[model samples]
Target: DDIAEAVISLEIMRDRATAHREDFETLYAAMHGLYSWFLRVCDADGKEYALKQHEQLFETWGATLSGEQSLSPLESAGLTQESVGDVMRALSAASKYNQELKEQKERMSGAALNTCEKVLNPLKFLLSNGATTARDYRVVIEKTLSDTEKALSTQAQRSSLARLPMDELVKIQFRCLNPALAFRELVGENGARSVILTSGTLAPLNSFASELGVDFPIRMEAQHCVDMNTQVWGSIVASGPSKRVLNAGFKSRSDWAFQDELGASLKEWAKVVPHGMLMFFPSFSLMEAIVHRWR
Candidate 1:
């Protein structure tokens, strides 16, 4: 009965999305459907429904891929496959994306509401880009993100957008679990046949390699796209008017005099810059206070 409800909810959402023909509406419907589906799947005995669905779809695709059998594709199923081969490919992508969605849900449990966007962004990309036949899957990704955002908004203490970066966007993270050990387990107990880690910021290769438990890893530096010496600029302002050290370190964070000085410095900087600028405060309370003072 719950499974039936979930299916019905998704169908209704799909209809609404089609009617609206807007990404936001489509995404909302998809997210709502996923939330319903998640509730049902999580309630199922042994929580095996979602896993079984992916596996069964995978087997169907595998048989088609191997030319063992042929099945008629139907637009109703969103299969619309050109042939048994196309159907199989579509099914394979759907299966993979579905699996990813499941993983994302599990990982996001108990996480801050604001963190949902970052967590769901990768799954969204996988469905929208790599999973061509997964129109339904793509919808689910959008829906999940929508649901997550809504959930996070209810939390009064969650970090605001200015402070957070979606993992899929910036491809950087801090103060979170390292994905290295998980990657090691995924490729193999030992590791993949060949593992390549390349990033411009991945300098001090030894430090990174050691953290990932890689032994004697080969390293190479790619050619720079521009001259760093000519392009890069920096500044240091270490002292205040009285030659007293000016710092916003944790020890001096709550000092009102320090904050006032910092604000004055920022105001001076703003006057020099013509267009616009951004200021990052350590905490929301501090930002609110600064803004109030400025006003």
Candidate 2:
């Protein structure tokens, strides 16, 4: 019953996605469907489902490039048989890696990492021009499958438990939370002799540089091109039209009275602000909440 419901939901999403002409939307629907199906099957069979999925993906892509198959877009885009073969090899390595993790209790081996890196050229070619053709979609699907295997490899490597729970494994999100580390990786040794960062938004330069783990021997702040007195008009309003405190802090921003007062203030401003008015909110959810309250 759960699998049937998931299939129905995926069909509905695919229908809606196809209604639009955008390829990314269709791709999103397909990925969502795959994930939904995986969740259900994983719940039923745990680790075996993941291993089987990897093996199936490897076999499917391998078959596509086998024999005298018509490779239209791939050949037209200058992707040689050898480049596509790299992606196939990566998929095979990924399947092997998953099997090893599941059975032999092995982490991501150096050989597996090198094999995964070998597909970078093919993946880049497929992703260079926005995914439009069926060939692009096929390569992308294989790339995503390979990436998921790599993510699972990482999870298995970092985890201390003998086996990671299926639920937790399914929910794993790979993200770079440390900006400093990312910056260091971006500016590797000998990559950049000197990095000059300049942006109007970088007001607190010290904090920004510290966050990036970089040091600038020479730092200069350029003045605004336009005279502030003549061109820009800025004001801080502590209270709204009703003299209600315009506190947009976490707790008070949602207060009915505060929202009402802010709306009233904007209404008055709209009458005199002339051509247009731009309102900025700290976050989209907060803006949505305020708009809902106003309506």
Candidate 3:
């Protein structure tokens, strides 16, 4: 049966990890077993004989989280066992990081993992199950975007990172649906409080509907920009002689020696802008090089 195969797969992992059974690898494998078992039961087309063999599993056990599934998670979550394992590890690390963040001192490595976990957990759950635990979706939205921002920040290229915040791009995946999970929940009381999957052109009343899963009817919406004028809208490029093509727009500010001058300009701008802006440096060591010729 698909269910048995799934469980066996996880158990094998557990057996290998018994030396450290409670280790992340072990817990992840266990969760994987539980999750994949549900998938096989819902698959009428996957393996008929196996589905029949384990159909009783669902009948005997309480309905698992059958109400949460989506498609994007399936694709983005990846398929290779190692890739899945790596992502799961990143997510688990992120979850631990988020929990610790609510308290005290932290692991720098975990900071990135925490955000990645937030992004992937809901996605993985949806892929495995057919419905999303709304809470997981929100977490994915939060961490995925944060990590994306962090990843992008480390890069010398911002223009290529795209315009939408990392969070929005990551969360865009929740729009995908998992039919089997939806049907499983619709069979009984284990379904969502309400689910309205429809389309409309004009709708955006709720404030957090997009963030929260509350926006009953998901659809495209018209946008209205602020009456206020653009305060600041620009771009940044990598700083270095070899990558000097970036000096096009800011010819006056282009001299490598003028790096300090740019910082001073930022300071001057900050006197009025307060904490609204941010200044990024390639590396702290570059401080001497940049400031020495400070523009």
Candidate 4:
């Protein structure tokens, strides 16, 4: 009965994957058609206005493909499911490529702009391909993505996008990091008698167990080496003399006013701090925006 259900699920996944590929191809064609139109039109105010509109629409299409734009809760609920993690990952990846396209559009001119294109190209085979199961496929894809991002970042020409060859391009799909199946897959379906997962601060045993997909894994929180309050130096500066609230969100990231305020706060904070101060952001894009402001 379990095997039969699994088979049915795989069939459903296969159908969905095919549909997604077709949807991507259609979007690519529409965007390409606009580009072609832009090329043929003689210099005119109407043509310029139409081209700008086409660029905006193309960006929207990319956002839709990447899942940065929202869908109904019912539609996106499967985003957490291990079975469809790869699908979500692939869709999420559209955002990265979309951002890349937006950044490069202004730079492409003449022969560069005329380069032949592959719309919604799927060079990497989907896990639905019979070679690998979803369980391990997520891990493999995540590792590969990490390596690819690292290589791209370290390249001398920082602004250039990492262009993968045709063979590896298909592999650039997203993979869910917290798939919640590591324990079961590692221990085997029969279950292991003894397995230990330990950390210095493993509080909230039930949540940890849920994340690991293990039933009631034992938890132990070690005593702190030093008082956290004594060791940590934290300060909150809500506003500077300008009396502007210092906060950051997707909408606020690009606003010069917000970036200026945030940048000023960080610069002041850095001046007082004697040691290294680590900062984190909700996304790489936001982090890059702030960093650019600092530069």
Q: How well does model 3 score by local distance difference test?
A: 0.39
Candidate 2 residues 126-162, lDDT tens each?
3333332223233111112222322334333443321
Stretches of model 3 off by over 4 angstroms after superposition: 1-73, 76-86, 93-111, 130-295
* CA lDDT scores, all candidates in order: 0.39, 0.47, 0.39, 0.39
Candidates ranked by TM-score: 4, 2, 1, 3
Best by TM-score: 4
1-295 per-residue lDDT for model 1 (tens digits): 2222323333333344322223323333333443443333233231322222223112111101111110111122232233223323332443343345455532222222223233333333222222232321211111011112212132222322122212111111112133443454445667578877678887677777766656645768776787879975668988655455667674465566676777677767787877887767788986786567556
Mind giving the per-residue lDDT tens digits that candidate 3 earns over 125-205?
A: 444423333323321111111333333332213332123333321112243233343344443466566655444423444
Clashes of each: 3, 0, 14, 2
Best by lDDT: 2
| C-alpha RMSD values across all candidates | 18.9, 20.0, 19.6, 16.2
